[model samples]
Target: MTTQTYTPNEEKRVYAGTTMLMIGSCIGASLLALGNRFSNLGWPLSTVYMTLAVIFSFWGYRQIIDACTYTRYSTIRSLLIVTWNKVIAEIVGYATMFLIFGFLVAYCVISSDYIHSIYNFFSKTPACNQPAAYDEGLCNEYIKCVAASNKVDKIIRAIVGGGAFMLLSFVSSVGILSLISSLSLILVVFSISVILGRCIEALIKGKLAHDSGGWTRREPPIPYKPDVWSVLIDFPSYFSLYTLIPTIPSLYAEMKGSISEKTKIIHRTSIYATVVLITIYMLLAYVTSATFYGSNQENYRQDNILNNFSDNDKLVLSVRILYVLVIFTAFVCCLFPCRAILLDIVKADRTTKRGKVLFFVTGIIIVLLLTILAIFVPSITLVFDIITSLFGFVLYLGLPILVGLKIPVLKARREYMEATRAAMHRKDPDTEMKQTNAMEAKIRDRTNSITAFLSVFGPGATERVRQASESIVRRMSMTSDRLSIGGRADRASSSSGRRLSSYRHSHIPFKGVPSTIPEASDLSKIETPPLNNVSLESEHARQQSRLQTIPETYEHDRNRVQEVTEPDTEEEETTHNISTRVVTEQVAIDHSHTISDEVLLEGFTPPKVSLKRQIILWTITSLFIITNSTSFVMTIIKIFSPKGNTGVCPK
Candidate 1:
């Protein structure tokens, strides 16, 4: 039966949808809630923590790249099987999936809280400028009187909020969730713009000044002594914690590329992005703190510093609305991957009708459960931090290093035997047995060194492999001389015979071969018609004839050879020579019965981190400290020292 292929629509959706998913999923509810939490620390400590989180994130990304390179596996489940046992892999995969689902639940709850707060605000606002309406107790009694007269507004608000969440879940399940996320990103951008503009205005007008005299003269400055403990515990830490879960899928996808190259990109991008995000967060925190301080206002209770500036700033109000909308969209986008990953862990591939049904049912159940939990859970931020930190630390840092070490160790011995056999086959017949044995020993040592070096995660692996392969080619040059001195036709036939003989002697069964090795006559039983004699009536017919004449086993072996051979196409002779050497080397190692599974599954022991890695790590650590320090100094200068006073009051 022919395999079903993805249509253009499906393929387009997968790539575009996935990219949008990454961008939207990256931002969430933490952006809104984190400002006040960090404000308590002032600005200096907040900037420092943000800088450090980025550094650690980059390091974590590099570790993932390293693990994926040696293991050559993309999915967490697949990587786990190679590093640990199958049982452990399955368990870890499931646990990670569950953590993602929990994030979705938290986002839902936070969204509900925001909607509830907005509703409560409108419901408490006085309809007319009546004293009875303004009085707290009178207003409560009037609201009760109004609710008895008109309960529709209260009921509608509840329905609108609850309905919005259910609609978001439904759209997400059908895979249109990314479109919703894009809309959310737009909202977030607008909100950030409003907040940033207000900050810039405050900074430019010197409104951040501290007053030395009551409502009069200002102090020269006091160094900003931000609460370090509060910053770490409440602000920057929460942002890092929230971003951790969303960071996993993107890093995991990046593992499909070359590990060494991709690790650098991930590391650099993470560091740079963190620095930028921290700067923005700190500036906003400082402005809000300066405005609200000494006003008997609790930091967390303050929603927008814009409200304090003027109720007439319609532009700022509009921006605030956009910001809230953006946050809401981001919350919706974050739910998709959490659901997707959970489904993956459960082995729900969505390929069958039954599987699709299961996905919908599971999503509905999760939403319902989360909505119930939201009623009881006081702080979504605390729950998010505990769950994300636990899983993100384990999956990103611990798993990759463990897997990189395991696979290389199991595969080393087989490569050694192959190198030994090739060296023996090339030696002169007249050479002393002891001398030939010595030469073989030298080849084995070289091959082992090459294999060991390649197992590490770096550019060095590629260079070492090229050097070892070239060394083998040089040895083959010497063997070619002895073969040419004999009759040309005789040498060619003898070379082929030697290759087959080596294969037989090495005792490694060919990949497709059964457990037992077949005799020479059995090898002869496998035949193909001459390529030149194949008939062709049309292009399709010619293609079919060519395909039919090729043995499935031969095609499979050729594909394997092509993987190594295609890169060196500048020299046809060299290509053939290398292919022959590689084939002979395999035979010498008794790999005749070797299958594709054996090569792919073959493990190698990763080399210990050398001095070079230590130096790089140290360099990164130093840079992180310097960058953080610079940002902190700038923030302090902006906050405590005032240039001139504007009409805006400093709390």
Candidate 2:
């Protein structure tokens, strides 16, 4: 048997790849779906939502950084270990992984639909011309019948749709999706070119119309209809809303960079790249919307504005290419995170080979299921909303905040104690203890400063401080025994224990020692004793014995201290102080640099402004959600409602 150690090539160019992955991952079927979503919010609200998305991007970046720095565990597993109890962490991790898999399944269905749409569009000419193979009258009648009654064809469509999704899933399992993704990128570039060309033409025409007195300002399109605003607002909202899933993988990769500085650079670059991509997307969307709305067509019927233009314009071949490219990229980018979460859940029990195999098998199953569902329930909007709103909220917003709260509790406890001591000593008037008091105050101050820094930056900053302090202790231990005792105790207490039982239980081979503490005997032995041959008095004594000692046990006391003070060496203290000052001074030098270097490195950045951005973003996103969901719900309601529209358009 041979052991293989995998090391990432340090010299690889990550910026371009990362940027593309981020863009591709973020923009998905949602871009087209959002056109309809934003239509409900109207143009003004939609613009506000787009701006809010930019703000949320920064906020999301900050939260990721906070989680990374505070958790000090590069892997999601490690962070979970520290933030959650072992059992909870495992459960949450598995749940998150399952959610990601669900998302991947949904993506596969969408990808198939996109491909199918393109295929049907191109094949139309031949199909229409071949009257022998294709009965135009029969097809027209079939479509009209479907349009007249949605119920008759729905069951059959569902089965076909599910089968198509399953096929894509099977293809993905066989690694065919990767090839598709690579080819899709080229198409994506072409599509962007087409969109840009159309946008330029529209803008030019609009300006020309204004100058020639051919343009008249008409009332805003469908002022009261929420669907109009939903389309406009949600379209741009895709920049942030869609980016969350893809960012997970990119952030994971960024953390794997060889140098910390490289990681920081990658993080910063991702933020700027995202902003730039969103700006381009927004511009394209605005132009498309404006052009379609400016025309005399019924506003609601102007679905897929970009595609509508591409169909008539020969020059928009490039734009169609870009759309395909985007679809491919989004699919690929999403796979990384989806696979990562899957690996996280299964890696403990399975080998890498087995894991990969399992991933493929599972993905295939999901693809099939989703495809069938899509076929029968061909509502992309409904599927996108359910997946995005439910899982996106959990992964992006809820999880990070929960993790952040856990890591800081210990440091916060230390700060509170030190503050209490400082207050107590301030009132003490004993002159003989002044020097001792001064030293205590100094220690408290240092701890306070470090804790404050950790609170703001996250656990990673604290770990760095601790490491620097340890190095200093190692160097100084040669000359001073006083420092050595403290350093050894710190290492013994901090290194051998502190993590929850579930985390330490699997790793440590020893059996007799407690799961949390190597020194203490197994707690289970004392907690649950043998039942045979025990007198009532003896049993009572034993029960009382267990009850009396449990609270005073070494493990319990150690845990208490662990919860208060993080172990630090004298050398580490000095190093921490110096590094803290350096980082602070660097921040003072340049704000953006601080943002890029420190904040972005963690995969999050704070909002440039205050809660205002969050408020606005949340409001618009909520509105978009409401309008889209309402429309979907209404469609369903209409289906069940008496004498309401239930007919589906002919295929």
Judged by lDDT against the true structure, how good is candidate 1?
0.47
- Residue 280: error of model 2 in Å? 1.9
Against the hidden reference, what TM-scores do the models get? 0.51, 0.50
Please give, for residues 152-210, the per-residue lDDT of candidate 1 as tens digits: 33343344335655566565343454565567756656666776666456546654222
Error of 2 at 267 (Å): 4.4
Task: Tell me each candidate's RMSD, in Å, in order.
Answer: 18.0, 20.9
Question: Candidate 2 residues 337-401, lDDT tens each?
Answer: 55556656555323567775876766565555555565554455555544444444455444544
Write down the worst ten-residue block by lDDT for model 1: 528-537
CA lDDT of each prediction against the hidden true structure = 0.47, 0.46
- Which candidate has the highest TM-score of all? 1
Give the least accurate 10-residue stretch of model 2, judged by summed lDDT: 125-134
